[model samples]
Target: MEYPDSEAQLPLPTLESKPEAQITKLPTRPRTVFKNQLVDSTKSSGSAGLANKKCRARSLWYALYLPQLSNLDPSQQEKYLNQLAGLMQSVSSTVSFHPQALICEIRSSLKYFAGIDVIHQKLQLLLEEQLQQWGLLDGFLYAASPTVTGSLLLAKSGHNTLVYQKDNLRSALGGLCTDVLDLDKEQRRRLHNMGVRYLRDIWRLPSNGLCKRFGSNFVNQLNKALGKAPEPTCNYIAPPIFITSYELPYELENLDRLLPIADEILAQLCDFLRRRDLSTSHLHFSLLHEKRDHTEIHIGLRQASRSQQHLMLLLETHFNRLTIPAPVIAVRVEVKNFDAFFGHSNSLLETNSLDATHYKDSKLIQFIEELQARLGEDHVKYVSCAAQHCPEHANMQLDYRGSSKPRLKKSSAGSISRNPRPLWLLQDPVRLNINKGRLFHRRVISIISGPERIETHWWSGADVRRDYYVAKELKGSRLWIYREKGGERGWYLHGIFA
Candidate 1:
């Protein structure tokens, strides 16, 4: 009848809606049964250690980016990585009412890895492998929990995970030490003296008395763990601005030589922060060299301060480790931090805006460009250091911002104390003649003096000297002259050979 009712058309599939962004941090209350359960579970299983790896859980973190880690300058690398760690640390401090300690949306990663857990596992593995190669084994971990919040909750709960899923969470937490409840040290001891050493003991206590004894925070954590109260989750503020770097002259393969260059560019960026009296929170590095392998490193500052020295130390440590290939072609560094100055005072150092004389980064940018021109980028350097004991090694050479560099030190050929330095030491020395205080450039020498002089490299067999007298010629020019054995004395241009 009437086409089986007008409303009876076939149903079409509609796509399900998904969250717009990944949940970056998760908050899980680690109280009662679930708390101790996580502890025993972790110690009983080997995977507990695996979970500690930073990349192991989803709700706690999102996409893990290992950029062209090899190409960045070390300073940037350290800052970047350390910042990541600090942010994760921040998650561990979430309030008890916070839900899901960490939540990294797997909507996209799920597409590539099969499932959210798989994606999380992959990232954790990546970090573990890389950190191992970098010789960093301590103070890092990643794990899974029944809820994204629980995993993060378990992290700061104590260095272990006794349980992971919602059902297992309670039993896993029963044995957890009371100290994991995010209480101050004094509060922890107070709980201890009150016979609430285990999370279960605290969980079983009367809520009204618990709150009265330890304040509302303790009761609040219990409520969140028991799913009675809502745990607020706050996303970390995404950086509004960031800066990065790259090195050219890709062929500069030596680590010793490259360290200075890396340091210099990073310093320039740090100096840029000084203009605004700003300090950065995070910095990262990528080292892209030859060979297929690349490396990325990072560092984070607890308090924002534009401290060049602090940042540099972290960078140098990582850089010093690299087993650089024969020749590296380039390096890159990125700074991922927002602008934060000490105060809003109007001093020149306190401003983040640019001025007429120079923009914040104008001078450094110009310097780098000009340096690339003359030194061909490859030969030019960004960093400098004092040379060593050898006169030839006195000062490390940096790219030109100033004066001409003297290529040579003192004579290695002679032991002469006063440095029988030529008026103009030449790559190719030209012998000269002198007679009675007049140079014989245009004529012959008229006088020879009693031999008195200095010589060098006697053991090494190089020898030369003379009772050099002021030389004269028909032209009347002064000359540096030395006598030879025979009667025939030859004269050649020396000082002004050019």
Candidate 2:
């Protein structure tokens, strides 16, 4: 490659002006693989030169590239990148996103997870697993280096490369084509016309000539990739709320087809919650139908949780009972409510503390959620003690959807007495025919205990004053009977004891 003459005063062409000068064609190359290297902590001569100056410490970064996703829409590509970012955040906090790649700095996380090699293996396994689940595992590449630019460049080369030493940076950059460089149409055409096909060709020319032709920005980018200059990268910030959608390749009408997709999304959702140390009480799923209609399914939990198994179980139960109105072309999952997770710890020895209660309560809540999901929420009901004096009105049925721990009314002066209540109570008292001062239905009934007086609810319109007793019938059945103190003055059957 010949360097342009400094004396030749020609105006550089702006990328916008020469639209047709873009490199529309390029040579195809096979995917390359580079061995992994442990980054050395010792400062190099190049780094030591700037050690006297205030330079940021070199951190190891890995770049992930998905070549197959290049043809996808920008928004779709970004969704995939965001999903990857959420997953990467689990292993490392510092993750940066690009148009076609993700850069993650895992230096600080190395020690906590053993070492870089183990982290690399774990990340690779996780990435492959997630990609397989998403059905996009082919043509995926990644590269690791101590510099962000280097890792990005190597990754863009469509290679699984890992470069640590400064000496190997040139080799990695040399293997890449000019298309990997951040250049527009005019600059790329000029480079190709000057016989600059590979990055190595750019290195052969004089820096001053290249600077004069392409301006200082091109040289700065090159220096950053070579680790001769500092490169600052913005870390990815996860959104406070999670709302992601997945478009199916074909409209799905069956539960089997839709459930796998939902499972994948829920897995990612669980990971997102786990990364933030949070839990969600409700998840709203909107199914986009083929006719442009929306069918919404909401899954609510009795308690906020991040457990994927529990969430999946509830979703499966709901889906089993659901009937899709139309074919769904897409699905969106959103978190309706989220809260910080203050996890519970179980005690080795049983006690009456909140933890023990919480353990039992969690299991009960899960059972209730499963039942409500399978049956309609309205079908399941909880019985709670109400603020009424009468035995028939003392307890009421509550909708299980919003039912928490039953807050039974404390023993108040007007509350029901400590006398034992029957397991079953009739909605209306049935009048009993008494003959010869003995109760009779089909046979003669004998009194098991003496009558207990009861009087209350005088302030309300309905005033009750009665004397109650427990009686035994011919078949060993027990009956609760009460006689009106004033009014019709008849005997009535109120309840039956088990």
The lDDT of each candidate is 0.47, 0.75
Write candidate 2's Cα lDDT for 1-498 as tens digits: 112112243344332322111111112222121123333343332453344234334466888878877888999888888877877876676788877888988655665676666777777777778878778854467888767888888888877777655667888788789998888899999999999999999989999999999989999999988988877676676655666667676778897777767777788788778877999999998988876668888998878888888998988888887788888877788784788896877667777577778788888888988998888788998787766667777778888765455666465435666776788888898888887988886567787885888788888878889999888778866888898999888988888898
Off by over 4 Å in 1: 1-117, 138-143, 146-149, 153-171, 207-371, 378-398, 401-498
Pick by lDDT: which candidate is best?
Answer: 2
- Candidate 1 lDDT over 131-164, as tens digits, reads 5666544234334444444445555555445343
lDDT of 1 at 418: 42
Best by TM-score: 2
Residue 53, model 1: Cα distance from true site in angstroms: 31
How many residue pairs clash (N, CA or C atoms closer than 3 angstroms) in each of the candidate models, in the order given?
92, 0
Per-model root-mean-square deviation over C-alphas: 16.8, 21.6
| Candidate 1 C-alpha error for residue 251, in Å | 25
